[model samples]
Target: MQHNLGVIGLGHWFGWLEKGVGEKGSLKLVKAVGTKPFEDKAKLLTGFGITKDRYYISDPDGKIPEEFFEGLDLVHISDPNKFHKAQAIESLEYGKRVIVEKTLAINEREFEEMKSFLKKKGMEDRIYLHLHYLHKQPTLALAREMPGLVAKYGKITSIEANFFEPVNEEDPRRTWLLAPENGGIFMDWVHTSEIIFRMTKCSFGGIKKASDFGVNTDYDSVNPTGVETVVEVSGSSYENGALATMRMAKGTEKALANKTLRIVFKSGFSVFACFPGHEAEFNNAGARGTLKILDAKGKEISSESLSGQNSSEIFISEILDFCDGKRVGLNLDEITEIFKSQWEYQRTAGTRRLITDRESIDAFLRNGASYTYCK
Candidate 1:
């Protein structure tokens, strides 16, 4: 059965989601609501059966129209961070299954409201949080093999994950992110904490904001003060003694392309997983990720490229299963744990200094920096 999909915000990711709907996929894109008309982009989407009439401009208030949800079986919320809770609740109120982007909500109050509203509607299983990283390989493969790896090695002692993106001078998304009300970089990159929680089953004890490197002056002339572009966070596992560190950056010319997760064990061995390039993954190609087992001395003992579906396909598959009435994706309990961890981090760290000078930007990018693919 083809499940109709209505998109609340046609931002950068919806294009990739469109690709995930392969010729015979179960989902279909019928109606969409964006802040603007998106003229040039509409030409491309018409091939997928979406016409000009299908694209509706959002109201200034950000409430989606009832007519838009009338015939939809599911709704995808890709709006700005602040709008997630309202749009998600509206979708549920209309009896539409929902797939939302990360950070569930900006704060605990909003999250609880969403939780309460969904439960009231009795559509808890109809919602899913699209944490694409969880579906990516070496993520899935490593998570599946964690127990065996722990048995062979010892218990995990620490985990380090890093995600960095080269600055795009022309990308308007960077400008949109500068508004403090938009949730800034912390809400965007909190998924790193989720990755840690999923693997260790430990909530973050406390998150310390190590540094915040905002956009460079020359790159973003509009906001000279800039918003957070790069940040380093360290936290210990709540239950287990394991430690986790994450560094996330965006909109910096000095930044390099890096996405990886490294898990170290007590027995003097570690496993490092490297994800595929973003373009390949978004293209719906069978992007392959690699996992390398290294000895304590950093000697590579074994390595293999694990092949699997990209995040887009994996997310679509899960949502389709959900539409079929099978329980999948994160449950309310899992969502609560992840949301609480993220909220604690945001409350404790807040926002740090805005790095405007070249010296500090270089310093923040020094450790855990990668140059494999520069932009």
Candidate 2:
């Protein structure tokens, strides 16, 4: 069955989705709604033979024409962070299955609104969050090997993850990313956070304590918003009693680019590294990296370079299953827990607070207080 897709954003990432579908032959690009006329420049449309008639530039008022929504089996929402909830809700209300990009919303209030609407309309099964990183080679390898590693090494005691991207102040591509309103490091780090959640089996136990700090010393002139060019987050997870820390940065020399995940168990440790690029890199034939596991005495237990499998390919395959009724969308409870922990961090940005219970987390989210740096 070929599911017709309506894409809400025409950014570079959309190209990966289009290419993945093209390769699988299980989906079709019927129409696209974006703020600009991206058809001419989008290699996916031209390369895949998607006709020009399928692209529709959104109205100046920012409304997508109602007609464009017709006959779409799936709507892929990859617009800016602020628009995610509304776009996903609208797509679901129109009876279209939706795959929304990560950071489902910029904050908890928006997430709750979308969650409530989905429940009210009984449309939970129709939506999925595009956490494609989970399907990446390194992540999949970790999941497949973690149980044995933990058993052999004892309990996981600490984790360190970092994703750094080089930024050019003159590059138009980063305009939205440099604005806090659109979500700076907070929005971009969702991938890293979800990776952590999965790696730990959602055992973070609600973020016992968290602290965040942001600095915009790099491109403050062009980014009047003073959005953080660098962000640092550290916290303790309740369940495993593990200390977790993450560092994300936007402005850096290309030579210094880095994306790495390291976890230390009671008796051993493992490290995974990949380039700092789109999730599609995991799918590229040339995309390869190393996973190194060491025992307590620093003796290498296993070390291997992984490559060949594409994360986008895996993601597209899973998406096809969802379309064919073989698999349900992302688990709502899992998503809720992730967002809850995210909100806790945002609520206490730059400070540390031990979130004692679910009720306390709920109160913080209900208050709808904006994260100071993000606001």
The all-Cα superposition gives candidate 1 an RMSD in Å to the true structure of: 3.6
lDDT of 1 at 320: 85
Q: Worst ten-residue run, lDDT, model 1? A: 224-233
lDDT of 1 by residue, 53-166 (tens): 788777876888778987899899988878888888888878888899875677777788888877887878888988767777767787688778888887777777767666
| Model 2 ranges with Cα > 4 A deviation | 38-48, 168-172, 205-240, 271-276, 279-286, 297-301, 350-375
Mind giving the per-residue lDDT tens digits that candidate 2 earns over 1-375?
A: 788888888776687787687777668877888786664557755665656776777665446778879888988988777778877877877888889888667777778888888788887778888875777777777767777776766666776666655555443444665465555556666666677676556544445444333223444433322112122223322224566665555554554446677777776554444532564374457665567776566566676778766777788888888787665545888787555555665655545323334464333322222211111
Model 2: how far residue 210 lies from native, Å:
5.9
List the candidate 1 regions with Cα displacement exceeding 4 Å.
Answer: 38-41, 215-240, 284-286, 349-351, 355-357, 370-375
Q: Give every collision pair in model 1.
A: none
